[model samples]
Target: MTRNIWTFITCGLLFSAAAVHAQSADIIISKGTDKTTIDASPFGASDPAGRMFIQVLTADLVRSGWFARGAQGASEYILSGSAGGGGGFVAQCRVAARGRSGTVFDRSYRGDANEVRRLAHEAADDILKALTGRDGMASARIALVGTLSGHKELYMADADGQGLVQLTGHKSVSITPSWHPDGDRLYYTSYAKGFPAIYELNLRGGSIDRVANYAGLNTGGVVSPDGRWMAMILSRDGNPELYVRRMPNGDPVRLTSTRRSAEASPTWSPDSRQIAFVSDMSGRPQVYVVGREGGQPRRLTLRGSENVSPDWGPNGLIAYSSRIGGRYQVCVLDPRSGDVKQITAPDADYEDPSWAPDSRHIAATRSIAYRSSVYLLDTLGDPPVALIDQKGDWTAPAWSPGR
Candidate 1:
């Protein structure tokens, strides 16, 4: 069977001119020489759900690039929590720094039994914020299309690959699941009507609606950060090209005009001014960027045999899958300096890298022996770890932006 090219999947500040410059100059970059060690104490020993919370919290912290799990000996921070209740589980969490000697985070979360994991994730994120002065991805989720039930279906899971829920029951073929910045909605392509069309799934209410149903192709729909524009691929005019359409309902403004070549995988820059997409106009598919208002497109990747699945991150970096030698690997490119860094090893093929909101980790599909599973790669130092232990052919992993 031929590999499906599309199936491989897939900021900003303001300030015055001179006053902003002075403030930016005052910003200091901190360079750390050692990883922060954290000891995560078991949550509720008597409650089964509480124990589950503890397990997930520890795993989430370990997966975070800034922290490591270990004993309290010589530990920089300690996280302890408890969960229990009769009608609903209540989690009381506390985090403290060893040297500072005061409680850094203390809070209580109350919800149904099913919310134990979510409460734990919230505590983990809070701990991260208290320690690193940055947000955490523990509470975030990932959207993907998998073949677990023998058909391509849309599924959503926690960032750690737990709480798997099928978003779409199309049971036909769904691909390219893209999350809105709010993380409550998703846009993807499905063949439920026997033709490729883009559909939006409201995760909160479980409502599905078709967003784009043009004549030819309606795939690779990516909603901008502002939720005002959607950059997608539509071939209604002639050849497959990149186009940006207004949210809800609006005619698309074509961005690419190559008459013979095709384009796929459109992504938006942090400021939503430019879009990075895949194009074959140069004979072989390569990554290219174009303005949202429809202008000339400039090629971005020049060294890879084939470059596709461009994901513009919140940190001003673009992550894509590049074919090196004979295997596909995840590569990050600095659009400003044209510097490229390959993040995956040569032993396995990794594809469809989606950046975590923190911009320090990426979730991608690692394939071996025709079996594919999602793996999270920390951009800093740790080795890639499997996102889930389930058996399935997972692809097109999209990490949710921070809530």
Candidate 2:
């Protein structure tokens, strides 16, 4: 397998070999920020599924960046939970503050026996919100393209990259997956019909619907946050230009009219009024923003020689991969002041940044030579952490809006 890291997102690549390995899901926000201590234990670290539950809960709390681990006597909050059952998976958790005698948080979760990890994640997130008043994304799902089976296919997994299941077995080429507002379906480009076209897959019902299959090229279909509109790249009108339609049934409104330049990877603003995309209009690809109502496009990135894969977050920050010092690194841009910051280390290649629901962290594909994996990058300056250690190339991660 050759390592074509730069053009992996634009042109799909396939790799051989597959292996199942679970890595620690621990993620910390930053070192200096004050994090309250909350401990969850006394269940079973040596037990079968109980151990799995504890590992997941510890990872979720530490990853949220709001809490830290403490000793039993010095901890600010103590959390006790039950995570074992003979039949169906059931979890019950309760939290109590140090000074208060009454329990501050109490909740129980029930799901299938195979969904124990998910139940644990939900419990951790619910307790996080109750104690810190901050939104938790432990239960968030990630949709990405993987070449594990020696063919390009769409795959999905939990935020920690567990319980990965293939979504599209087209056995052909499928890439560029985007989630709908409801999170029950995905909008992606596939060659199942022997042509590059856009389709939507319902996660629940397994129904695939074709969204766009224009003449020349049809790819990069992303729905707006509000779900009323969709922005995509189409070459039906000649050189691939940015197009927006009213979603279910509306006319395509062309946004860019460049003659020879190409446009790809369209992302929506939190308000769904503006769109940030990648365009090679200036002889080099850079991040650009255009209105959904169709207007003149404006370049948004000036610091990098090459920038691509712009993901606009709810906190008004756009994350993209920038070519810094001849290497692709993760960089975030404040579209307001034109300020740019590089968050990934410049030692390896990283691209296709998708912001998490909280906007405090990003999910992106980090490639070190021919191997690639999905990693979570903290916007607050913590070192990059791999969300999964499973073998095979995992690229183009799209994070769901934490449910």
TM-score of 2: 0.89
Q: Please give the distance, in angstroms, between residue 232's alpha carbon in candidate 2 and its true position after superposition.
A: 0.7
For all candidates, the clash counts are 0, 0
* Model 1 lDDT per residue over 1-403, tens place: 1112211211011112213433221111122225788887534545788778778777777777777875755677877767776788877878777778768888888899888888878877877787889888999999987888889998889888989988888889999999888888999999999999999999889899998999999999999998899998999997898888998678888888899899999999999899999999999999999888878889888675799998999999999998976999887877886656666665689999999987888999999988898999765535678887776799889998897
* lDDT agreement with native, every candidate: 0.81, 0.81
Clashing pairs in 2: none
Clashing pairs in 1: none
What value does the lDDT take at residue 225 in candidate 2? 89
lDDT of 2 at 72: 79
Per-residue alpha-carbon lDDT of model 2 for 196-257, expressed as tens digits?
99999999999999889888899999999899998989999888999998978587789989
